[model samples]
Target: MPDLATFQREMRKAMVAGGVPSTTLEGAVVSDTLPAERRIRVHQNNYRESLCRALMSLFPVARVFVGEQFIKGVFAKYIAREPPCEAVLSHYGAGLPDFLAEFAPVCQVPYLRDIIRLEWAIHSLQLVEEFGNALSADGTPRLSPNVRLVDSDYPILNLWMAGTGQIPPEAVSLKAGGQCALVTLSGGEVRLAALDSAQRQTALRIEAGEPVEGDSLTMLTEMGAVDFHAG
Candidate 1:
């Protein structure tokens, strides 16, 4: 007989992926309300439902972009492939951006992946506690714990905002070129700012290479996108 830990692991896998395992359940748990398999299914359904809701909360824009039925299908595959490793639901969808990037069915919306990234950043910032100084010894600034930057070849910010119904769709033009976004949360207010050409270039270079040019770094410092303190 499998050890208790091994058996439990296998049982969980079975519950998530299929009907309870064919392996004998000599001492398997039984629910008074239903057979063990049926009871396990109820738990499985609830688990998936919870995760699905979390995903929706994090990526409302993506959900709108893809439509309800399509998002449900995506969530089904997402649940099967990327079971939560963390207990925190807010942290659960960190990989979703990459997952959507590679998911072939979503290719129609090539910018969808970046949209997910933006939403994930928002979701994560709400849960992540701030720490450390936002400034360094060289008078340069570091990124705030709640601050994030992303660049994509699409107007992801406008799309996300419009999808959420926060702004009029007419205000955003899909034909307009790429965008860089600076996301920050301050005093419980979350804001997404569009970056200018220089700022966007600086942000891209910052992520890909080292610090940007001095002037751009200074701009970052001025905008408080860079760290402002050592603590």
Candidate 2:
């Protein structure tokens, strides 16, 4: 008989794909009505469908951007290669953004990777209870626990807005150049703010714990996006 670890590894493979070794399948508790092979298939189907749904929920905008059929096919391919590492379903598709960077089908849609990244950033922040203190000791504003930075060479913000029905699809221009954004969670809702080059630099500086001075900092403070510390 295979060791426990070997048996578990084989079982995992069986759950992911067919071709379960007869020796392994024989260990299943067989009943008169259902055989072990058929039982494993039922579990495999549910496992695959659940993970696929998790990926779809993680990147709803991406699904809208690429149509249900395309996204489903792409995700099905991804699921076959990568399995869940942990129990948390929300965190399952973290690597998908990088996966898309190399996925051949999306080669023409270069921005899809960044869109997944943006969505992942938002999804990740929702799991955090808090980022950190409100401000640095020196009075420089600091990024909130909920703030996430995403910089993309494509007009991903417009694309995301369009995908979410916030704007008309015609409003997005892929040739409009790159865009940067600060994604934050406010009052339990995710918010996106587009930033110019200078503003992006300022935000980056703050993230690095460097002292920064600018109208962007001041405005963010006024908007309660960042808290100002009195020196």
Candidate 3:
């Protein structure tokens, strides 16, 4: 009899490589509704499709740029190359922005990479807002986990807003793509506020959990953006 590890090994092979690892599994499956290979393909498709939908949900801006058919094809290859690790589903495609940056097929669509980065930042922040408060006790200034900088050499935030219909599509000029911003959720609202160079660095440092102080932090607090003080 095959051990559990052996069975799992074969299952992985079937799901990923599309073939039986052993004759044992081949003979063991008693399917009345479909052939064994067909059944295995169904399982594989379901697993990949679930992850595909999750990726699109996380990076809707990227989805708009590539369109459904194109994005589906892109993710089919991405899923093959970067299978999810033992993490939550929301974190599965954390490396996708990096993946798309180097993906040869998407090289012409450079904006797609930056858009992926910005969308990933928003998705991550939204998840944090959904799950954690991360505010400081007392009246000390602090930022929730949802606050983070999205630095891009493209107008990725505009593209996102336009794609989501929050702004007119023509309001964002694809030819003039360059901006940076801080993404956060406030009172159940997702906001992407523009940022300057120093402000961008400050946001990055704060998100890194560094104890930030100085002009940038002072300005942010003065602007009422960094005051999480309960009082």
Candidate 4:
């Protein structure tokens, strides 16, 4: 008899891989109405479908761009390659951006990976709690905890906003060049704004725990990207 740990490992592999049950698992699953292999298949399908739904929800923009069947296929492979290790699905697809980067089918749409990266940033903002006051008594600048910086070699913001119908299609051009953005959550809504080179540098410096000054700070402050605190 396989130990409980060994059985769990095999069960996870069987469920995610969606292959014939290993002999050990087949022998272990005692069933009456369905054979052990058939029962395993049922569970496998359910698990795969659930994970597929999770991935779709996490990257809805990606879904709209890639189509349901194609995204599902890519997700199926991702699930097989990187099975969920935790019960919380909110953070489950963190690796998806990198996975898409190397995925051969996605090569034709090179910017797709950057789109996923932006989507993940937006998704992550949902978990950050709102902090009070961007400025403290001492006037040191403190960025909102919900703020995230995403720099892409593609016009990801234009593409994303255009694709979601938030902006006119004519407003976007693939040749319009790369973009940097500050993604933040406010009043329970996610917001994204393009940042210029100087603002991007200031944001990166803030993230790296470095001091920043000058017009960049003013720009970030006006955009509600920072608060003055005495940190």
Local error of candidate 3 at residue 185 (angstroms)? 3.1
On TM-score, the candidate that comes out on top is 4
For model 3, how does the per-residue alpha-carbon lDDT over 1-231 read when each residue is reduced to its tens digit? Answer: 477787777777777665443576655566677777677677778878888898877877777777888888888888888888865988877788788877898877778887777777777766764434445775555655546566777777788788788999889986875677777666666677777768767766766666677788877654445745544
- Write down the worst ten-residue block by lDDT for model 3: 222-231
Q: What TM-score does candidate 1 get on C-alpha atoms?
A: 0.85
Report the lDDT tens digits of candidate 4 across residue range 1-231: 699999999998799778898999999988788888998898999999999999988888887777889889999999999989999999899999888877899987888888888989998888868765555556656676767778888898998997688989788888988899789787788899999989988887877767889999888877778885635
Worst 10 residues of 4 by lDDT: 132-141
Q: Which residue runs does candidate 2 get wrong by more than 4 Å?
A: 1-6, 17-22, 26-36, 130-133, 138-141, 208-211, 223-230
| Candidate order (TM-score) | 4, 1, 2, 3
**Candidate 1's residue-wise lDDT over 112-216, tens digit each?**
888888888877777767654345567434566667897878998888889889889899887898888898777676778898888877766655545555677
Give per-residue CA lDDT, model 2, range 23-110, as digits (tens). Answer: 6655753645876777777777888888888898888999887888898878887888788888988878887877777789998778
Q: Candidate 3: where are CA atoms >4 Å away?
A: 19-24, 31-34, 129-144, 201-217, 222-231
Highest-scoring model, lDDT: 4
Candidate 4 residue-wise lDDT at 142: 63
Q: In model 4, which runs have C-alpha deviations exceeding 4 angstroms? A: 1-5, 30-34, 134-143, 168-170
Task: Let me know the TM-score candidate 2 reaches against the reference structure.
Answer: 0.83
Instruction: Tell me model 4's lDDT, rounded to 2 decimals.
Output: 0.85
Clashes of 4: 6
